[model samples]
Target chain A: MLKKRIIPCLDIKNGRTVKGVNFIDIRDAGDPIELAKKYMQEGADELVFLDITATIEKRKTLAELVEKIAKEINIPFTVGGGINSIEDVSLIIKAGADKVSINSSAVKRPELISEIASQFGSQCVVVAIDTKFENNDWFVYVNGGKVPTLLKTIDWAIKAETLGAGEILLTSMNNDGTKNGFALDITRKICQAVNIPVIASGGAGKKEHFKDVFTQTIASGALAASIFHFGEIPIPELKNYLKTQNIPVR
Target chain B: MIAIIKYNAGNTKSVENAIRRIGFNSIVTDDISTIVAAKKVIFPGVGEASSAMSYLKKYQLDEVIRSLKQPVLGICLGQQLMCKHSEEGNTDCLGIFNTKVRLFPPKEIVPQMGWNNLQGMKGDLFKGICDEDNVYFVHSYYAELSEETSAACDYILPFSAAMQKNNFYATQFHPEKSASVGEKILKNFLEL
Candidate 1:
């Protein structure tokens, strides 16, 4: 049976791991390669490294950091942040990343999704959607959640699947860094709307939040940053907790 | 020395890294001589079927691979292309295995990504690996079960998780990216 994945997302800035509340006011976490190795030892199913400073700084995701992580860790990992072109995806994948996530670039050019999927296969292309519920509807935000777009969250997810995204990393801006819980409603809606796998991100404060997202929504994975980075929740203990709750975790 | 067959596929680097982690040296190359002369050949791939097959054919790697006598392992797309046919590009494959690859029904998630357990293990490749041990997978098309199936995994349906026949072995999952369980399997392959 396919088990629910517990993913630790490392938000990378200037070669260092950092976590921010609400995608702002970022704080230093630790070294990325060390944290990645620790997560692998702790039984993380997968890892996601978002180059949070790539887009804003007009620099590509640190390929050196990606290669280091790839060399040190054995599990599957995705590299995201400033990936905007086929060449960008090529660099990261060549550096040993299993997948690459795109947000602003994909939104700016929807065809970019199909281009990367066609060039590197859809399975390696992860479409990350940062969303916020406002005025009773969820809107897609891009540029690391600094800019809002006209695309509705659900609509964008469905369209991304059509454009050949193999997975959706749905992060609720409203719940991000809140440590409350996941945005179950939007996560469920997007999961229902897309045939590809959806990873519920943001607002993961406790192990129960992982349970809530997996049981309440059809999310294939639950991703968190601060909780895992700060040792607030160790992955092995969390997996054990999930297993007892009848959630098939690995 | 080990040779990792490379031809227009993704994730070869990760495979090489994994080999290094397991304390073995490997070269990522498409050269026929290098692959033929290696003690073991790791045929790792992550890409579309038809294009990958064409690249293999372009360099006559299809024939070289079929002629290999040493232990040869195929991963993900490598496994699918080793089959007789694939519904992905409606393309004919290497025919190393007599199974057909089909797209999963849309009744569930298409890719079936993340960690999934393997069952019915019966080959040297799974020597120390336990039944129901989880391994990482990321693929939309799967090869059907056949006489060569050494292990199985269920997603939308029961499919070939690992298949073996003589010197040729294949897996629908990415063992290099499957962490410790995968490391054990790779170590087993290297030992064999």
Candidate 2:
């Protein structure tokens, strides 16, 4: 049995956390290392640092920041955003990142996943899918929800697993900042299609939403940003609630 | 010098860095002579039991580890494999501790990964550590708490958080990732 993980994602740009209201009105949260340390102390099962910048110059800065945080924190962490090549994955893994998550590059170059999986094992590779429900059909959105891929959400997740992704991180753009709950149907459908663990990202308001998602959806973990950032729901309290609900948490 | 027995474990470098942070030089190795000659040995691993045990046998480390006269420390999978037997590979362990490694059960979480409470610590490893200190753990299998258990954590069942039997000591958590509480535990092992 694997426990349901509670993760706090920190979207980084210019060495600061950019928080948005509904993913807009960006505000400075703090340094990536400091915020990550705070979350780890607060019982974050894992941390995700999304380098919001994709430009050539920003890449090095993101790697430096990742190295700083990785050196500072002791828990497992994943680095995403602008991870386009196998070299990037290898560099981050060597820099002490427990896992490297690929999004747009994985969708564009499907072979990269298997190449990485074959070399570094699937357990170290994670495929993060940003999805937006457009015209009643779920379309895979890439480039941080700026570009849309041709694959459907469910189909893309199944393909990712076949491509040797150990974990699937599904983020619902439509429900991302809604603070309602997870896309339970989408989570369940994706979980049923793929045997790999699925991490449900986006759309969490209260602590009870975690319980609802874990029970209604087949999700293995829940990831949130604003809710955890603003201290709306601390992780330990959330885990305590889930524990009372008979949901396994760590 | 602190020597970390590394036969392809993921967390060895992290442990090395942690020791360095405390002003100590450590070596990560699988060499029996180097380990046997060291004043202290730390067995660190983050892999499945079958493959790890295979590495031990492939390198003939099982016999070397059993015959170690100096203090030996095991972490996470290292601790589980120090027990009598493991269901991970249906393999026989070094039996340094009178315990058995078993799956976490299907109904419960398989890999109990994250920070959890450690209680009832009673060795030099907990010298400056307190009860309920959160230590980072990641594994699908765990060692059952027997008389050798020094500390315990509760998930689906009360499992061994730390174990001590003579010079053989083990912990189901990564003290390297455990912040100040864990740093102290590692320091205690070094001083022991």
Candidate 3:
């Protein structure tokens, strides 16, 4: 059985890790490389670095950051945020990222997903959808859930897979940073609709929430940020809890 | 020099990076002699088996790989094609290992991805890793567990995680993508 993956998302801005991370146990934690190493040591199953800054110059810096971080640490990492073209996909894959996740760019140019998939393989491309519930409908949002789009969550997900996306990373804006629990209804719905793997993001407050998403919602994986950064929940402890619950976690 | 055999697979660049990180110089090559004279060989690939196998046969790499004396490691699709046959392409493999690869039953889900534990690792590839250690896998078809299986992981059933019969060692999962556990596995193979 496949183990339920526990991922800690790092929000990178201008090529720096968001919070302080004790890397070598000798320095301050604001460095992305240090934080990434610490998380790997702490038993994070995988790491996701979402680069929120979008610009031609920032793209080069993001790739440089990915190359630096990947050299020191040996883990599968996915880098997203402002990724917009086939060249960006090529550069990131060459920069040591295992997967290149596209949000706004993928939505605007659906062919980019197919294009990247054709060149990089579907497994190397991850389609991240940021959604917010408005008037009881899940509308896709871009720019880190700041702008609204006409795409529906489930509808867009099906299209992403058809466009050669290997997996779907769905983040619920209503639940992000709230820690209420997962948006079970939405997560489950997407899981049922797509044949590809769906990683539930947004609200994950505790270990039990991890259990709920894996068991009740049948999500392939659960992702979180605030809890992990604040020490509210440790990655290994949460994985152990899920293992006992018969979640096939490693 | 280490040569990572390239069939135009997606993850070949990462293979080159892993070797570089471990202080090795490697080149991505499909040429026969370049691979034959290399100190160690890495066969890294990710894509449809049918298409990949076609490339190998077309380039005559299928023959060169079988004749190598040094240790060779295959990741994901590279491993599946090392077997006798694969249901993936209605394709036959190089026959380095005795078993045949097949797609997961239709009733069971296809493309079982993410982290999965490898238990009972018996070869040098798993020297430092334990039975409970997990490795990342991303594939829809797997080589059914056989006598050559060195380690096994259960998705719908117990399947091969790592397999070894002789100088040829193969794993269905990507050690390059598996993090610390993956790094250790790669180190073990290098030391082997």
Candidate 4:
């Protein structure tokens, strides 16, 4: 059986983790590599490092950080944020990232998904969609959720799969940081609309929220940042809780 | 020394890193001599079947891999290419293992990704690894179960998780990315 994955996303800026990760025992809270190793130890099925770094010049720093994390961590990890071209994807993959996630660049050029998918197999290409329920319709947002697009969230997700994305990282802007729960309706709709796996991101506050997403929707994975970082919900305990709920997790 | 075959496939760097983590030195190369002379040869890949097979033939790595006497392990697409044929590109494979690769039915997810458990294990490669231990996998096509199948996994259908025949061993999952369970499998291969 394929287990539901528990992923902890690390937001990076200038090669250092951006979000305040409140791990008590962690020596350097900013060191992405250290935080990555800790997540792997805590039974995180996979990790996502979203490079929130601003300047294009410092892209090399993310690659270096990826290489460092790859050497130390054995599980799969994906690198995203600011990846706009084949060269950026190549640099990260060659640096040992298992996959690369693309957002605005892909929206700007839908062919970018096909390009990366062709160069490196589709399995290495992750299409991240930032969506918010607006005007009684789910709208796809770009530029880190600042710019709204005409594309509907479900339509964009289906389009991305057709363009050769192996996975969909669906983050609900409305549910993000709310701690209410996942946007189950949109998530289930997208999961039903696409053959590829859908990872439900944002709004993960407690263990039950994880349970609600997995049981309520066909989400293959659940991703949260502060909850895992601040020790609000330890991964091992969550996995155990899911197992009891009859949700297979790893 | 270990030689990880380098071609047009992805994940060679990760395999090399995994080897280094286990306290062994390996070189990522397509040189026939280096692969032939190494104590172990790892054919790790993540790519399409036909293009990968053509690249292997273009560099004559196919023949070199087919004739390797030392313990040789294939990962993911590496395992698929070792089979006799693949439905992916309707391409003929290395024929090291007498099996056929078929695409999973669209009744379920096309590319079954993430961690899945292995069963019916029987080989030196599975030493110390328990049955139903999960390993990471990401592939759309799978090799059919055969006499060479050392381990099996079920998702959509029962397929070869790991296969072995003489010096050639293959795994449909990425052992390098499978964390501790994978580390144990790689350690077993290195020890063998």
lDDT of 2 by residue, A121-198 (tens): 566678999998888888899877988878999999889888878788999998999999888888888878876778
Candidate 3 error regions (>4 Å): A19-26, A244-246, B20-25, B107-109
lDDT of 3 by residue, B120-155 (tens): 778789888987788889887888889999999888
Q: Kindly report the docking quality category of candidate 4.
A: high
Worst 10 residues of 1 chain A by lDDT: A20-29
Best model number under lDDT: 4
Residue B183 error, candidate 1, Å? 0.8
**DockQ, per-model, please?**
0.89, 0.23, 0.59, 0.86
Point to the candidate with the largest DockQ: 1
Candidates' lDDT values, in order?
0.89, 0.81, 0.84, 0.94
**How do the residues A76-128 of candidate 3 rate in per-residue lDDT, one tens digit apiece?**
88988888889888888888888888998888889999999888788878899
Query: In every candidate, how many clashes are there?
Result: 0, 3, 5, 0
Scored against the true structure, residue A182 in model 4 reaches a CA lDDT of 94
| Candidates by TM-score, descending order | 4, 1, 3, 2
Chain A (candidate 1) TM-score to true chain A: 0.93
Pick the winner on lDDT between candidates 1 and 3: 1
Q: Report how far off residue A143 is in candidate 4 (Å).
A: 0.3
* Residues forming the 10-long window of minimal summed lDDT in candidate 3 chain A: A19-28
Best first by lDDT, ranked: 4, 1, 3, 2
